[model samples]
Target: MSQRVPNILLEQLSDFINKEMGLFFSKERKLDLLRGVSLAAEEFGFSDTEMCINWLLSSPLKKRQIEVLARYLTIGETYFFREARIIQALEREILPAIVEKRRNTSRMIRIWSAGCCSGEEPYSIAILLSRIIPDIESWKIVVLGTDINVDFLDKAQRGIYREWSFRNTPFWLREKYFIKTDDGAYEILPQIKRLVSFSYLNLVQQESPEYLNLQGFDIILCRNVLMYFSQPQVLSVINRFYQSLNDKGWLIVGSSEASHVLFPQFRTVNFPGAIVFQKDLSMEVSRAENVLFDMEIDDLIPATTTNYDFSALLNADNSIEEEAEDEDEFTKAVNFYEQGKYKLAAELFKTLLNDPVFADNPQVYILLAKSYANTGDLKHALHWCNKGVKKYRLEFQLYQLQAEIYQEMGKLDKALDALKNVIYLEPDSFAAYFIMGNLSKQLGKTKEAKKCFENAEKLLRLKERDDVLKEFDGITAGRMIHVIESMKSMESPG
Candidate 1:
């Protein structure tokens, strides 16, 4: 007979798990946690669930014990080609461009599948890569699959799967990449098997030195994982992901997890069938191509022009071409900003400000301010932001940018004023309220902070769960609500 866990003990265990592993269990999830704890007690040979919870709380858990707990608590609910559009985008668009770019270089491509369960996602990538690249033997390809669950990693290492894993996978893929086993399981072919490697990685616990030592990956897929983590943990992992990617590398999260708040640094690239974030390296080149393609030559020369000066026409064309080049330079500056080459970006942005065409562009001023701010030139950043506000008085983003600079400079009052301006301009601005909450908290005004957080949460709840919370850095609204609730809990008295 199994011993029952009390509600108090269950809450303690839930809190323990959340703090240690960064996995939150809501009121509804507490039952699931209790069930997992019961299973863990049985596995660890505890007499009762209370005894198991006491043991976990009293001392540091062993590696094996942690693995046993993970097996019970974490769900391994995934399939090969789970989101087919992402895979299709990789196959038809992303991989080909990467292949062509790296053809003359080292011809090396590295991909990471974070939280890979049962080895399906990474193997699918390997199989896809194999199909895309001709003369595959010449190129060095690496697909690393990592998960906290040792059981999942072990299964992934075996590279064998049942029919359920291929529920959404195309039929032709199985024929090409897998062999049927006598036990009715399918084993991945050696070709696909050799391309992938699996390892145990706790996303929350992994240090920068250990995980980011071998940076400059071509692509990273961390889908459906951040949804399980706390805001701070998710932010930490996303920052690491940003550092891990090479210039122009891609990061693909689950569709629901995409957020402007969480991924403010990444440039969102919308493909025909999918959207992926990129650490943009060649922004200028892409911008220039788009500009050229978009310009209508017929529009430039009026259809009624009977005796248009050929030299004037040529000069007009030359001006349009120069404008495109100037736009390209602006994009290059923005790219520099994204890459943390802020000093270089600031210089370029300043030079562009001298151009009459760009002088009045609010975006140019905003970028200049951001670049200065990033490089620790708060004085100049404030100056540019002020100038932007004077020129575009109603621009809410300018005020928001000013608030950020003020906050960075320790001008709390000024930051609050700027945030107020942002809120006044855009009443539904979740970011402004969130910032106000942080500012209030810093000043020890717990009540004000709590109210601000509540306001932000209410506004966020009104939006789609999957919509990137631009105010929170690209984290989803669902995740921000968790963050707010956590903050509210801390603010509450014992």
Candidate 2:
């Protein structure tokens, strides 16, 4: 075991991994890295005295082991609500403001937590959503947790953690969300299991996350994860994170992690010990990775209020519509919404609402709600949501939409209630379980969050391969379990 991996061997290992598994590990900490390589050899029955060190050099998987070595070398050290200030800012300032700003489009919020390890961080985010917004129970909320280590992800899914993981957990969360296992480990309860999702992801893997490309999330938390990487690696990871978030979205990182302020695309904002980097989301991701230019903040905001009112779209006038025969109602409304013409959509909805004969239909109410939501007027959007809920009593779609609006408004409690109603109304929907997991995570219910993610993954896997990929936003490029690269170098026992 003392036969150390040489400097050239480390670079060779990295190149080998890149060829075999499409992942790369830089060489800044080569000395600290061989330990992982040695461990992997032991794990895979390759750590043999007779295997001869040179034999280890030829195997293709030797490279793959390097990536896995990184995972084993790096420990994901975090817990439920490890930092209070960032979560507080998310609840009070970020979500609500974003909601007010995005009322004109579909109410969708996707978030990602990388290097989620044993699931505490994403679960922490879920807990915040549950506590801050009651109506979030029904949103199209997507919280994805990814890590390179498959074994760790398995533990993360189990949601049973030791006390050390909850070192900074608040008393209220401890009381409400988890139950102590027979062995004294704290396990997540079912209430927190319905809102989050997890998968295996390699940060240095050359491919753009297939699952992420389909979703331009509102927030991404890469936190302490990037600190382990070299400067080139850091820049690469940050660029990827930028591509991952939507316009005007935010990225939260550990307070002491390397200062990303020098990175051109992001603006640093201090939040207690945690610092948030606001993504200049004015531009969409370019097809080429070469477009690494700094982002530009656009002045194209739809509204200034912190909370949105969707009912406002009902003000669009119908007077001018009769003269335009070529423009159909749905088309005109959709066009205006897409073009950021909230006022035009509002006028159209207004005309429709003014017509007492056609205004009260549940369909119209749904349209009106969407219009207001598109225009960044969530209050009015909620108003329309309530109307649709009443008109189509027992339908969960309206509730789901409402829940998303509440999440955006940072009303985790309300959002949870909506999701609860959805689950109660349709036990087999499975989507409710996903939302529930996120809410629980926001409440610092790690165990619950993991369960929810597991449930969602189970449901997704039950479907056909294509269907599963479609359901999870088309992340079909790799396996759910990614074994790192460095570990593959050891000689296999004959």
Candidate 3:
């Protein structure tokens, strides 16, 4: 007979799982959480569900306990070419561009499947690359499949799959790439398996030193993984993804996770029934080309014969071109900022201020200040932030940026005041409330922090479950609510 877990205990387990594994379970999914825990209890040597729950909540979890729990809790439900649209996009558009770019130069390609479950997705990628690239033996290819679950990695390393894993795919793929074992399970061909390597990685622990080698990727497929993370964690992971890619590299996220708000810095490329983000190259070269063409056309005209002041006309044309050039420079500066070249980014952002056209732009102020803040030039960062706030008083983002600079300077009171100004501008901003909550907690204002957290939760509840809160860095409303609940539970006295 199965023993049921108590509601209160289930809530605590939900919080624990979310914090430890970056997986979320809302109130509606408590029964699912209970069932997973119930099944994992036997493996953990617990006789009953209640005892297992108590053991988990009793003390800090050991790594062995976490591994056992991960085996049961995480879902490994994926098939070869699971999302056909993404595969098609890769085959037709994305990969061809990459191959064309590297065909004559590096002859190297790297791809990472961040949440690869049971080895299917990365193998599918290898198979696709083999079909697309000629003389494949000459190319240096690496397709990395990483997951938090060791069991999944072990299964992936074996390169075996059942018929269920081949659902919706053509029979020829099996015949071409897989061999039938004695037990009737399909084993991937040794050649296809050779192209891929499996490893254990927890996305939440990306900041740890072990993951330092996770850079210089050509394409990263993190489909359906970010949905499980809390909003702030999702933002952090996305920012890291931006850093992971080579210049002009691609990022393919799940359809549900596709939001311009989440990936604002990346260029959104729309294909047939699919959308992917790319780290675009700077537009400076193209603008300079345009400038050269304009000058060439001016050179063709007779300079002395024309009654018109062609010089002034050229200056007018140059003025328009200069604005476009500044915008391109801004884009390049943002790329530098994302790449952590903070000093270079700061220098470029300062030049944008010489032109009032770009200076009046509010984002210039925000990024400029952030560039300085990132470089540890807090004084200059605060100065720009305060100037931005003065010029764009109604812009809540400036005040928010100012608050961050103040917080970095350890001026907690001023930071709180800036946040208050943000609330005044946008009364229903849940993110503001959330940030204020953390800031309050930092100041040791426990009661005020609780009130702020509650307010943030209230605002989140009014949004649709799947609506990505852009202010919260693309976390869905439901996940934020769960995150708040988890924080409250941890703060509560037992």
Candidate 4:
């Protein structure tokens, strides 16, 4: 007979994972991994490995199942033009200069969409460049979109999407670019296809990132892509990005990912709800320029002014005036919130709650609620959730939070009720529908539950983009399929 795994082995495994992945799972967190392990055991017909993982992550370890679960659960459903604000800034500030910098020289502006799931993000940037840069006819542009999932890359190269992918995209551009087929699908045009290139890139794979041969990209967009990684992984990727860029090149990331870059080599360019960073190029210029690099984090705050002298860090040969532009204080708060410092983020947001400009803004409240929720303060989280809903009854995000919070509290009925409101406000929220269906099944609400599962399946199928997210879709379909089959079996008159 095989010897059972020891408690010490499990503890060591959990410790290694915590150090490597930044996901804590002591003896208390065993249950967190239990459901997943249980499911695996039911399939595998043996509980040793799964049991070891479960025991390692149980209550004695810490209730870290959800955090551990994040590594597997979320889908990286990114496309080009993921964030409008950064895209706008790219058009206004970065692209123009990049084009000019390459004007007389190689005259080529190279860009990469690292971890691009399907072709959406790279194509979006390429299309924007084509629209903004006047000499696109003569200028050379290289855009590469890459992903680890070969299936996803294949879908990206094919360039077809169902309606959901274009939910936020402007329709007029759709007509100008994509050709609609008789069966209600859109295909990207050859011209736009020619603008970008595609390949496979598994971020955490042991192999090096694809396209190691290429260098000096004018812009690199790895937005919404970094937070999924362990800190060391992110640090490695960020360093690669720093090396890959030419001097003064820009890095556009997700609105929430600013804290991932605290290195002195990059300086932040803050916008209202977004910020981008550029490579700091002045250390080689003068000894006086080195002073900006040495400024301690403690000196970052100017108690009286509430602003940092950002230009001192930049290299501008021109002697100019010192005038602050139309800068928003809220962006700084958004940056904090994105970095997972929920307590500090909540505190920063609380101070801004009194400002009339944000007094009635539902979004600010929603952000505050998310911050509170992240910190494990369910009561305060729900309080802010209700506050957001009172004024902005139609905001679906708050409803999603309430559903999650209620579900966590084991108030299944209340969670479903909250989700029902979400459906009423926004009929197309696949997330809310999926949760509703899952919760309905969990609560044993048979007939109504079957309807929700069917609805979720329909919505997800409707939104499927060339099966680009087939694996992601498959997992959801698998969960729903079992419930749906159970309902069918229950309904049969035996």
Candidate 5:
């Protein structure tokens, strides 16, 4: 019989996996870690799980070995139109904005699906564009799908899928865009298949990402993938993504994974049931050309001022100008926020709110709230968020931010109400339903909690079985259902 993997061995493997693969396996997940390692052991030419564990611990794993391990550690199950609301937002709001903006100019659109598995996502993007763009033939469209798993990439390249892969897809999608093969698998039509290019990418291990021309993308989708990574690795990957996108480009993550705290560099754009990160290259450019603000100040200062000592007066004016230029409040607050100086950021952002130039800007309100929240000042965070909501009643992100603050404060009822407003504004939001379910359970509202969980399950049923729910940190829909069932069973009396 194959020996059972020991606890000590499992602990060592967990650390090694986190260090080498940037995938974390906490003590609670050691069994999962052990199981994955055991599966990888067979591929590594070892039958005994304990022996494979020791071997993996003793030496640095090769690229191929890590790739094999990744196949087991990461969930690859995905289907067309997996996150229906997110896809709808892209098709209705985002793509139209990009197309109209570029129609008169470059007529080019580039989308990257980072961690794309089995080609479903990028292919869906291509298909969506094909449906929307009237002159798609004239536009230079690049939809790139990249994954670390070679097997996944090979399957993606083949463009064939069984009925299982069509779960939650529209009835007409397959008939309209695919051809039935003799082997009984549906193959993506040539036109759609040719629109997407599949490539191998190890996001964690890539020393240089430029080889893939990983820049100037109009949209990057890295959904449900970062939850597996260590916190530092997540931050590193997110920052790299920030650099890769074009000005005003969008980053669509799993709704549950969306957080202003995590993506402070990007501006939040909320669509119905979705929150996407946008690269504001204009802000970076403004910071870069802050010297231009100096020219404005120079022009404002009188060329000749009435004074007894003209040269001395000019020197004093020069000192004053230098001070004003150095103290650009908005730019300094953004820099402080980026540097993680929440107190200083809050102070600076507060200063901007009083200025006529920034008083009405919703971004200022959001940033101020985030700065306060980061510093553990929930009261101030909620206050600013409420102020933002009052000013921009239609802005759903403000309500979302308010809900987070209430949850952090352990005010479950308030949090539930805040999330209700979020749902009212964005009825199809999976995150709202999932989070509200947890909050309802915490408040001992068993029936309400069940209703919420059932609502969430209905949304999950529309996804592939193995597809991870982003907000729950790598928990698959099937696993989450099991959790809900277990909770119910435990709560039931004999």
Candidate 6:
């Protein structure tokens, strides 16, 4: 019989796995961890779990060794049209918009399914796109499915699935899209299968050649993948996704991850039963507001004033100039922020909080919070975010800011609670879902993390091109998708 793993050794092994793969196996999961280690030991030619643990800790694991361990750790649980609402939204709203936008342009649509297990999601996208476009042959339609698991990618490329894969699928869809095999498996029709291609991609390695080459996608779907990642790893992958997208490109993460904090750069678009993020064309405000305001001030305050009482005239001009400068303070604060003078920017933003002109502007609070955060004043940043939430109860952005502040302070529960408010306001907030997933994982609530990741994936699958994200600091939709897939592998079976 194999020797049992010691408690201390088990904890050490768990920590090693968590650090390497961003997977957390708590004390509750000790038995499962032991089993996985035992299997890994057998596969790696070690005599026992202890040997396996020592080897894993001491040696740099080869790519093939990592892949083997991943196979044991990850579970592939997916189906065609897993989330039907996303597909319906894509067919009805997102796709039409992309088609119209591209009609005069390239007339091409490129979609990527990052962490596509067994090829179901990408194939579904291809099938749906073909159904919508009559002239699909004339258009450049690229659907690529990628995963870290070579086994899953190989299975996806084979284009075969069992009955379990179609549990929720309509009969007509199965009949239309697939043919029954003699061995009780269903083989996807060649026409639909040809539309999608599968490959290996590890989202964690952002600097990899495969990741660098992935760019200019019109739509990218990454679902149920990020719940397993470390926060820094998640952030790195998200940044890559931002870089991968074309301007106005759509990034679909799981619906649960629809929070503005995760994709602060992406614009949020709400459709019936779906929420998606779009990379917006960078809008350049002409600086005309400041210029026009300045011009008006110049016009009002004449260079030479030789009228009635000089002192009275000067007082009147000073009052007018003060009022105008007050209005211009907002612009000045923003410029300070751009110039990296966070403290001054924060003070200016705070000053405007009480101004009647800025009272109703939620952006003021967001900027104030950002300024504080930039200055490492997390406490003040959190305070401003909460104040904004109280004042503008319906604005999800305030809650998102609060979550960020809480996260920065290492108050994970507070961050999770803040994200709950963001989700309450915008159910499709992918960033919130992603953050919640991370928080839940940290708390050892594996199932909850999985569900949150799944929700984010569903929402992300319906996005289109030319859609602007409401806010995405640096993270991209593509990277979030990869995170979701990476997390999916680590989720405990329900």
Best by lDDT: 3
> Which scores greater on TM-score, model 1 or model 2?
1
Q: Scored by CA lDDT, what does every candidate get?
A: 0.73, 0.58, 0.74, 0.60, 0.72, 0.69
- Candidate 3's residue-wise lDDT over 329-396, tens digit each? 87777666644456887889889988776888998888888777766788998998888888999999
Q: lDDT tens string, model 5, 369-426?
A: 9888766787998899999999998877788788877876777788888889988998
> What's model 3's overall lDDT?
0.74
**When superposed on Cα atoms, how far off is each prediction in RMSD?**
15.5, 21.1, 17.5, 16.9, 18.7, 19.3
The alpha-carbon root-mean-square deviation between model 6 and the true structure, to one decimal in Å, is 19.3
Per residue, candidate 2 scores C-alpha lDDT tens digits across 88-131 of: 56766787676555544665568898778879888877766666
Reference-based TM-score of each model: 0.58, 0.51, 0.56, 0.49, 0.62, 0.58
Model 3: residue 184 alpha-carbon error in angstroms: 2.3
lDDT of 4 by residue, 296-397 (tens): 221211111111112211112111223245556576566566544568778878878899887777778877877776666879988988888888888877
- Looking at candidate 3, the ten consecutive residues that score lowest on lDDT are 301-310
- Pick out the ten consecutive residues of candidate 6 with the lowest summed lDDT: 300-309
Candidate 1 differs from the real structure by a C-alpha RMSD in angstroms, to one decimal, of 15.5
Clashes of each: 9, 87, 0, 18, 0, 45
User: Against the true structure, whose TM-score is highest?
Assistant: 5
Show the lowest summed lDDT stretch of 10 residues, model 5. Answer: 300-309
What TM-score does candidate 2 reach?
0.51
| Two-way lDDT contest, 1 vs 3, winner | 3
TM-score, model 5 to reference: 0.62
Off by over 4 Å in 4: 1-74, 205-211, 284-494
**Candidate 6: tens digits of C-alpha lDDT, residues 120-148:** 88998887887778788788888999887
